[model samples]
Target: MSYLIKPAGYQALLDLQQTEMGIKRIKDFFQQNLSSELKLRRVTAPLFVLKGMGINDDLNGVERAVNFPIKDMQDASAEIVHSLAKWKRLTLADYYINEGYGIYTDMNAIRADEELGNLHSLYVDQWDWERVMTPKDRNVEFLKKVVNRIYSAMVRTEYLVYEAFPVITPVLPEEITFLHAEELLQRYPGLTAKEREDSAAKEFGAVFIIGIGCKLSSGEPHDGRAPDYDDWITETENGYRGLNGDLIVWNPVLQRSVELSSMGIRVDREALLEQLRISGQESRQELYFHKRLLAGELPQSIGGGIGQSRLCMFYLRKGHIGEIQAAIWPQEMRLEAEKNGMPLI
Candidate 1:
């Protein structure tokens, strides 16, 4: 069954027509501002990659990847990308990209297993980015610095959005709150990780939730991430605090944060092996690309995917994600949104 959210009188926030224009202006402003700030050169990305290349992100190792047979390559299959996290790292290594700079690409994909909802569809699109870094750059301070740059970019984008559409009340904060996942669990032992993110972000206006993938003090992943990318202990998960002090967690299940991105420090050789052992995905070591990586064939890098639609949704503040993009939705959800005066694009 599909899920619904209480609009909290958010129904009349923006008229439908202005919302559309705001989405366009906001996207343009951020792309220009972020590209300038990050020194990112935009590149074209693929929707599907050859299977067995170790390029596709296996989210939590269980989500199904949409795949199709390759007509030209005998016995080969191509799968729609889940994210560019792994692929970007490989690209950096293969290209011998220099340290302290990177690239961003428009990545589009299909997530067939995504449960239908106000926030999710089989369709996915994002800005996938990665950069080469020195060994010394792979530390908490560096990561936090990068996150701050990103947050600053977001804030700048928000300002431009407001300038274009004054109706937006500047829901995003100027600074981001930072914390470890374990600390959050300690702060709210009874609440789930989602609840913890919500509470913390609500308090800080913007927050970076750290320590993903590995088991929290509660003995479960604060949330599942592919064990290959982010280092759980050192890495922090990030999200924006909402005006309501609610965690802007994308309720993909309920059409919330819309998870515009999943980014992290790419695993180094040793961390890669350790993560493999911990997740019992050692069998993957035999995969073609995995074997090369295990043999230290890949380069050290960091990367992630930022959801295009999710960013649009955040700036627009529309109740349902459908307002900004075209995608399939369950029948009941369509009717429910209409009943609440929400329009699907």
Candidate 2:
């Protein structure tokens, strides 16, 4: 079921040794740029949390978390985090972080249910970050401002990477274009959601599509978003809606749209209850995290994860994500990549 492709004339921009060094350079440079740009401090994060704590991210509200029972704590279960989407917000409150400041962590996760593909594997790594914000900051304008800052950091990282390894030419645009999901749907009414993204990314070079979770005019969402996080359904000013979106860039080597990050303004109490109701997840209201959030115990915040391997693949000009990160791939995929001179890590 993997969507395999052998990009014509594709080749790794860096060899095995150079790739290893490049990864460190990229990770270090990007993290520094990101932290400085967003005023974020590095923090340590947990690999797993106690089951039933409502701290684990229920991505798409269906994918299961890798869970097991703690031997000494009878009947106590632990689940590997899918993402720090919820945990980061809780941490901001726990650390007593004030508004205008935040924290970022090197988040590692395992998504056992992830479909194997050129862009996906069971292993996941990202830079997860969250910041405290006032109620007045949770709007479309602020969301756009944050998105631009992240994009700037990405651009700066690209420049540094190319400077260190001149062999890899920069492919990112000077500025990323912004588009609404509804606008994209209207432009390509005949195309499916993925196809629409591909079309937009190709046209714009880089694009951020807003209003991801809510039902569009076509009676379906541009993409599925968990209700407990990203405020994708809230109505904001200036005819803008949904304070969350994904940052996508057209990968020239793969000839496809690659999503590097999914971020947005976190939901407030009202938006949380409303989004949960819309997604028919009202039962989550009884969960500990949800209950605490509804009771105004957590901080108002904005956060998201920037995929480590995805960025590496894109910047390294590799056709498949496996070229950047070590992961299991189907035998056929391995043969295909080998045939094209693209080796799996």
Candidate 3:
């Protein structure tokens, strides 16, 4: 079953026109800032890739992609991409993008299996970006540096929002705190994974949790990750077991932590084989995309998706993601939001 949160005493901060203008302002400023900060070029991306090619991301290794048969093409099936995680890496090789430069796209997707909630939606929109890197750059320190650059872009965008919408004050910290998932589990041994995130974000205002997807001392993984893309199995220099993580911030309005992004270094030959073996999906290595990676045909890169509506919700101080994006909501959900004075767009 799906879940929803209705913040008490919630009220729309901006009218329809004002909200539209605010979204535009935020998108414009942040897109420019992010591209410049990461040295990325805007590119067109595919909404769907041919099925059975292993070109699409299998998010969490469970959610099913929306698929259909195309008649004109011999009834070949096409799967709507869950995210551009794998596709972006292939694009890097196809375009021969030099090291240190990358591509970013406005990735739109439909998560048919998604659970409706305060932030969850069937429709997903994000800035899916990837940058080429050398094997030497696949370390915790380099990942932290890239994360800081992204955080700086967000900070500048927050200041811009404050200048325009004085009512929405800037709340993001000057710097985001970085902590490993194991460290977090140790600090809050009694709390669940989500609870730990809330506690850390509340304390630091913003935080980046490193070493996700791998099992900690508790014997269960902090979170599940697909075995193909993110090198979550690799041991880091800091003695952690993951090379990727998520950046989250405490949303004062929602009184909960909202994850802004998840990224990591792409799995190299060694990492991929091991992760596949551990996940018990070694047969995937024979797939086309996997074969290319195994043959060293793709570039070693770092990539992730940053939600567009989530960012807008943070800057606009909206209580629910539906307020920032137009998507079909359950009748009861809509009525409850409306009754609580939380306008859904």
Candidate 4:
């Protein structure tokens, strides 16, 4: 029921200058820590992609993408990406990346219709990563292992951030709890998914609400995630929840795993076909990426996105998202935040 609960003790700690410095330090530290932990390589990612390639994340199956006309190319619109979910997978396959190694890229996107709030933003930024996987490592256990590694990287990043910005102390909950969507539903049949997450997170301090895509007993997915990357059944849940009922969910949480590199035993030709049929996206086979996937040309990989802004915000312990990033804010919202003593950075 609480979409936005304004925080008390309103004070913006970092000025624009300190905020900038803190942002850079946080980013630099996270990059170093994550790359080292996951054995990931930093690569360049595109700001836009060719539409209809099925490479773009259709967030919630509805949000509009910022578009521009490609000069001298008739009728070809270059869409600013919402996120590079499918692209990274294809990149691993096309680039012939080896197993046990993956790529991380700075991904920036424009979401035209994002609801302006303390957290939501029109401009998106994250570390999108993907890597090759073998047929053997696609299961709940592997997913849990990967999640733990990612959390460790986060904790390490927090430590590094505190080193530079001693004033910012983020007491990240030590252990991350994992729970299935069904289990959450069973626990709180009356609560909505977000409400369940809030309750569970409040109790557990951190949680990864897993098993997206499949309908619950309520006949709806606890959240929506695209069909292609994660094998819904095998992938367990992951995410952090803060003490004040804040969910660790960020970036395109359910819609696109922040690091969208889910390379579980690449669905064999048969399983792939079955999934395609079930998702009603067999038509995707016509796309370049889908074709390669069907033909077994791509490598098996598991990857995900790590929200840069979310990480920065988490480290800074800022209440609203605007405190950490320089992005557009409406006058009314700015005024309201200003009244609360939280200035826009």
Candidate 5:
């Protein structure tokens, strides 16, 4: 069953009409700020890729993709993209993007297997971005630097949103704290991974928990990340591991941690092989995308997806993701949201 959290004395900060305007404003403002800060150029991305091409994100290696046969082409099937993690890397090479430069796209996807809840939705919309980088740049310091840039963009966008919609106060901290997953595990040994995230976010206001996807000292990953994209198994010069992580914040509306992005440095050939072996997904090395990576055909890059609607929901202090995006919801959830005066778009 999906979980729900209803904050006490919660109400819509902006009415439906105003919320519509606020969504557009936030999207515009954030994208501009992000592109400027990251040296990214906006680009067009595909909604679906041909099946058997191994282009779709196999999120957790379990969630199924929405696929169908193309009538005009015999034996050809197209699958709706879950995210552009792998595709973006190929695009960098195709566009001949140089190091320090990249591209960002407004990506819309369908997660058919997603469970319904205040934070979870079947429809996913995010700013998917990728940037080329030199081998020397693939380190924890570079990852943290890029993360701080993104965080700065978010803080700037928050101020802009608050100025336009005064009722929606800003709750984000001026600077976000960084914590490693293993440290969090040590700090809260009795808590589950999600519970640890909640404790850290509540205490720090905003945090970036590093070292995801790889098994911690406890013999389980702090969170699940796809093996192909993030180089989670590699350790840095300081003995810290994982080149990727999630940006989590304390959401007052839900009284829980809200993850706004999942990103990391794209895996190189060695890291990819190691991660595949560790995740027991070595068979994927035969897939078209995986083969190209193994052959060193794709560019070295860092990339991630920032949820557009989730950011709006958090910045606007909405109770649910559906309030900022048009998406299907369960009847019971709709009724519950209505009873709580929470608007779902």
Candidate 6:
């Protein structure tokens, strides 16, 4: 069964028509701003890729992906992309995307195993981006520099929405705070992972939690990260072990922390092999993409996905994600959202 969240006395700030307009504006303005800030080019992305090539993101590594047989190719199966995490890196090499430049695309996918809720949906849409980089740019400082630029774009988009609608005031802070996962654990020793994020996001207004996949002093990872794409195993100057993290903010409507993006410096040859063995996914080395990386054929880069619906929902101040995008929902969840006055598109 799917889950439901009914925020107390929640109301959408924009009407259906206004919400649609705001979504378009956010999508257009943010992509343009992102491209300018990051020196990226827009590229067309794929809906599905041939199976068994290890090109798709595993997210937390256990969610099932939707796959079907291709009739024209004698029933060869293809899997809908989870995200273009690895594909973007390969593209950077193929297109000869110069150093310090990147690419972005409209990424859509089916997260069939997603537990439907106010935020989670079976239909996933996001902006997948990647850029070529040098080994010197693989540290924490460089990662934060990129994140701040993205956060700045988000703040700009928030103001743009307010310009169109007076009622939706800009709520994003001028600057976002950063903390490592270990630091957060030290502050809130008793809370679960989500609870810790909620506390930090609520207090800071906007935050970026670092070292996400590394095993902390508590002998557990603050959260799970797929082993292949993000370089979550490397030690940093601060002794933290991740070059990736999520940008989170407190959503007034839902009264919960909302994750806007998850990105990191892509893993290099050494980091990739180490992470694979640690996750017990060493068999991936034989895959086409893995072989290329292991053989040093792919370029070094940083990449990530920014959720389209999530961003729209945040800027539009919608109580539920359904107010932003159309996607499959369980009957029970639909009834609950309607009763709570959240009309699903």
- Selected candidate, larger TM-score, 5 vs 6: 6
Candidate 5, residues 165-217, lDDT tens digits: the string is 88778888999998889989999889999999999999999999998887888
- TM-scores, one per candidate: 0.90, 0.97, 0.99, 0.87, 0.98, 0.99
- What TM-score does candidate 2 get on C-alpha atoms? 0.97
Report the C-alpha lDDT of model 3 over 1-345, residue by residue, as the tens digit.
677787877777788788899999998889898899889999999999999989899988889999999999999999999999999999999999999999999999999999987899999999999999988898999898999999999999999989998988899999999999999999988999999999999999999998888889999888889999998888877688988999999998899999989999889999999999999999999998899999999999999999999999998999888889999898899988888777677
List per-prediction Cα lDDT, in the order shown: 0.69, 0.90, 0.92, 0.68, 0.90, 0.92
Error of 5 at 61 (Å): 0.8
Per-residue lDDT over 167-252 for candidate 6, one digit per residue giving the tens place of the 0 to 100 score: 99888999999999999999998999899999999999999999878899999998999998999899999888999999999998
Candidate 6 achieves a global lDDT of 0.92
Where does the lowest 10-residue lDDT sum fall in candidate 2?
232-241
Pick out the ten consecutive residues of candidate 4 with the lowest summed lDDT: 238-247
lDDT of 2 by residue, 1-345 (tens): 676788998777788998888889899999999999899999999999998878899889899999999999996899999999999998998899999999999999999999887799889999999988899997877888999999999998898889988988888899999888999999988999999999999998999999989888888899999999999878877564698999999999888899999999999999999998988889999998899899999999999999999998888888888888898888988988899978887
Error of 3 at 215 (Å): 1.0
Error of 2 at 156 (Å): 0.9
Could you tell me the TM-score of candidate 1?
Answer: 0.90
Identify the superior model by lDDT, candidate 3 or candidate 5.
Answer: 3
Superpose all Cα atoms of candidate 5 onto the true structure and report the RMSD in Å to 1 decimal. Answer: 1.0
| Tens-digit lDDT string for candidate 4 (1-345) | 112335666566667787788889888877888888888888889999988877787655667788888888886888899888778888887687888988899999888888777667777788888778777775666666777787787778778877877876656577677777778899977988877876776666556665665566787777665566555533323332110111253322122112212222234455556656767778877887777777888777677677788777666766667777778888777777878766876
Task: Report the Cα lDDT for residue 281, model 3.
Answer: 96
